[model samples]
Structure formats: C-alpha cells, structure tokens
Target chain A: MTARFAVGDRVRVDDRTPPGHIRTPWYIRGKSGVVADMVGAFADPEDSARGGDGLPERPLYRVRFRQTVAWPDYAGDGRDTVDIEIFEHWLEPESG
Target chain B: MSTNVDDHDHDHARTFVPDEEDSLGQYAIVEMAVRELLIEKGVFSADEFRQGLEVFDKAGPHLGARAVARAWTDPAYKESLLSDGSAAVKEFGVDMNLTELYVVENTPRVHNVIVCTLCSCYPKPLLGAPPDWYKSRNYRSRMVREPRAVLAEFGTTLPDGVEVRVHDSTATMRYMVLPMRPEGTADLTREQLEALVNRDAMIGVTVVPAP
Candidate 1:
C-alpha cells in the first residue's frame, strides 16, 4: 500500500489506547510532531501479536518530537529531540 | 528408629535439597515440550531448529564493527551506510535480509542513542542478542526520559553543547548508531579500528576510546 503522509507532514499520535499490542509509546501519544522519514511498509504488528495473518501492511513513519515537549521535566537543552516510529493508523494530521 | 542412626543420617542427607533458582530450567522444559509437539506434528525437524540457532550464534558485534570501521575510513561508503545500512553491510558479507536498518550518526552537534521502548528490537543480524541491561525495564523506560543520565551511568559524559537524540525502535525498523570515530586513531589499521569498536559504542551508551 502507498504511504499517506510524506517526510515533512505534521501529525499527531492518536491518544486512544487499543486493547492489544501497539508499537506507539505512551509518552508520544497525543503529542504532535513532524514526520522525519518514511520507514516503508510492513505487517501490522497488532494483528501479528494475536497470531492473525498480518496482511494489509501499513506505512510507518519516524516522528520527531522536541525533548521539552515529550517530557515536561526534561533536563536537556532545547536542542535535544526524540524520534519514534509510529504506524499510519496511529497518526492523524494536525489541524491548523 | 533410633536403632539405625547411621542409616537415618544418610536419609537426612538425601532429603536436604538446595534452594537454587535455575532461570533457564523452566524455559528449557517448556521449550522441549513445545519442540516435541511440533516435531510430532511434522512442523519442523529438530535439526532445522538447531541450524537456525547456530546462525544466530555465529553473528556478533564484530560484523557491525567492520561496517563502522569501513565507514570511518571511506566517506562515500559512510554516505551509503547512513542512507541504507542494510545494503551497505552486505559489502562486508553481513546479510540483514529484509530487516530495515537505519544507521544514526553521532556528530559533534548531535549525539545519537537507541532504545527499544516497547521491546528489545535490535539489529540482531549484526550485533547478536542485546546485552542484558539493554533489555531491562529500567533502561527501556529511563533511556527515553533521561538519556544523559543513562549514558553517564555507562561512564559516558557528553559535552553540554551536544544535542542528545534518542531513537526509539518502536516499529519493524531496527537502529544502530554509527559512532563518531575517536580522535588520534588516524594511524591505526582497519583491523585495529574494528577492535576498538565495541557493542556499547554502537548502542550509543559510550564512545570508542582512542587507543
């Protein structure tokens, strides 16, 4: 399947927690970030976790977030940043 | 019963059992049972399972060290490595298959560190299984929260000017750090350079010290 978001699109991770194994971390959930890179498509790990055939691969993107935004008590300078790989289903385009 | 004191002493000796925790004992029992079931069902033979394990056993950090050393010496190769790590490692006879490898570089301004926040997703083809600490819950949770503190525990103290970029391996992609080549190693041979590259350095816990 083709990727919906490009390298520079702004997106926010969906905050809702699903009942199964998810690749997105809790800290990055509901946080907004810019897409760093497209990591190609692969089997949805959520489905694979349940022993179900992981078909209909989803595009994964490396989302970059400022360290300060991720952690309120972040000790580092503003230059620090974190990159997390999030599946397309977990991300939504940020509204203006 | 008191008539046979010698026989009673031996019986007590037999009854005394040491309380030791064999961490792998339980897993081994389960693994053997599962293997037997699979074999009985004609899934895969024991020989095939052993062969697969042997492949993982043969892989080590040296393979990744070779790739890092090559990148240090060759600029064009470094570019290729930074762009496509899985493809560039093939030059050194390391096959990563379809596993996506993204090589993050550690520069003067940017210091890159990696962690599998969800689970232990590592570049096992090049570096083998992760060290015990890498898979610990402390490292997984703390690394993303306080990378500098974690690095310091590994005896790595970076300058305040550098930006600590932590890459969370949260998806199918696995990451390896292309650590900055230590200064004063210009005269060293390729093999010597490779020797200096350790697993921790690639994981971004510490830098390769100059030898």
Candidate 2:
C-alpha cells in the first residue's frame, strides 16, 4: 500500500481508546510529530496479534516528536526528541 | 561445623526428580498444551521446535557487540548499518526473524536510548534476551518520561548540550544504540574493540569506555 505520509510531513496520532490489542503507546496518543522515515510496509500488527493473517500490509513510519512538545515539563535539551514507529492508520496529516 | 564428603551419609532422594511440566504454572501449562496440540496436529515436528529452541539458546549479546565494533572501524559499513540495519546485520549472518532494526548512532550532539513502553519487545537475535531491568514497568514508564534522570541512574550523565533521543519500540521496529568509539581505541583491532562493548552500551544506558 502507498504511504499517505512522507518524511518531514507533520502528522498527529489518532487519539482513540479502542478496546483490544493496540501497539501505539499511550503517551504518544494525540501528539503531533514529523515523519522521519518510511520503514517499508508490513502486515497490520493489530490483526496479527489476534491470530488472523495480517495481509494487505500497511505502511509504517518513524515519527520524530520534540520532547518539549510531548511533555510540558520535559527536563531535557530543547533538541531532544522521541522517535516512535506508527502505522499509517494511526496517523493523520497535520495542517498548519 | 566442617563436614567432609567422604564421611557423609548417602541418604539422598534418588528417584524424586522434579518434572518440568509438573512445576510449570498456568501459562506454561497452556504453552505446553498448545505445543502438544500443534505437534499432534502435524503443524510442525517436535524436532523443528527443539532445533529452534537450540538456535535461540545460542544467541548472545556478543553478536551485537561484533556488529558495533565493525561499524566503529568501517565507515562505509557503518553507513549501511545506520541506513538499513536489518540488511546490514544479515551480511554478517545475523537473523532478525522478520523484524526491522533501527541502529541509532550516538554522537557528540545526540545520545540515544531504547525502550519498549508497550511491552518488552527486544532484539533477542542480536542482543540475546532482554535483561530484567529493561522489562520492569518502572523503566518502561519512566525512561520515556524522564530519560535524562533514568540515564543518570545508570551512571550515564550526558552533557546539557547533547540531546537525549529516546526511541520507544512501540511497534515492529527494534532499536540498538551504536555507541561512540572511545578516544583511545583508534589502534585497537575490531576484535579487541568488540570486547569493550557490552549489552548496556548497546541499549544506550552507557558508553564504551576507552581502553
């Protein structure tokens, strides 16, 4: 599947709290970050976690979020960042 | 009282060996049951499962150390490792088991650390099993929240100017830190350099000490 986001694209993680197996970390939920890299396509992990064949792969990206943005009281250099792996479906394009 | 083996009574429980299955808890029993069901169903042979276990047992952190040492010595190879870590490790015959690898480099400007906040998803093939501390809920939760403080607890005090980048392994990607080569290691061979690297350094908790 084609990746909806590209490197440097600002995207916000979908802030849904659906019940069941989820890979996205809670601290990262509802946060916005820039796509760092497209780490190839892979089967949807939520599908695989439930014993179903994770076919129709989805694109995954490495997203970079500034620590200051993620945490209000972040106690590190302004340049500090957190990189997380997020699936295409968990992300939405951020508009200025 | 100093007891001697020669004068000891030979009254030990000989036939009361503890069976592995009997000692297992509910989860282990379920795992054994599932394995037996799969084997009974001819999904895979017992020998295949045994061989897979043997292969996993042989994996160790030395594999990752060697890879890091190679990267320290060879710039071109280091570039490949930083770009496509899974493929680069494959060149040295390390199997990633279909998981993608991200090799983050530690430089003067940046210090990198890895954690699986969701669960303990580590690079077992390259760096052996996850250490107990890495699997702790405290480390998983705190590392992302206050990385610099957690790092200081490990005796790693990064300068204020150096940015601390934390890589949360929340998805399929596995992370390994490529520690900066120590100042005095220029003359050391790759094999010698490998000796300086340990599991903690690769996890980004510490730096490779100058030898």
lDDT string for model 1 (B1-211, tens) is 2356578776676577655455658788798799999988989998899987887897889988998999999999999999988898877666776577799999999999999988898999889889999999999999998998898899999997999999999887779999999999999998999999999999999998988
Candidate 1 clash pair list: none
How far off is residue B19 in model 2, in Å?
A: 8.0
User: Measured against the native two-chain assembly using Cα atoms, what DockQ does each of the candidate structures obtain, in the order listed?
Assistant: 0.79, 0.86
Question: Which digits, one per residue and each the tens of the lDDT, describe model 2 over residues B1-211?
Answer: 2255454342243235454544768898899899999999999999999988987887788989988999988999899999999989887677888787789999999999999988898988888899999999999999998998899999999876898999999777899999999997888999999999999999999988888
- lDDT, model 2: 0.89
Interface RMSD for all numbered candidates? 0.7, 0.8
All candidates: TM-score: 0.88, 0.90
Error of 1 at A2 (Å): 2.6
Say which docking band candidate 2 falls in: high
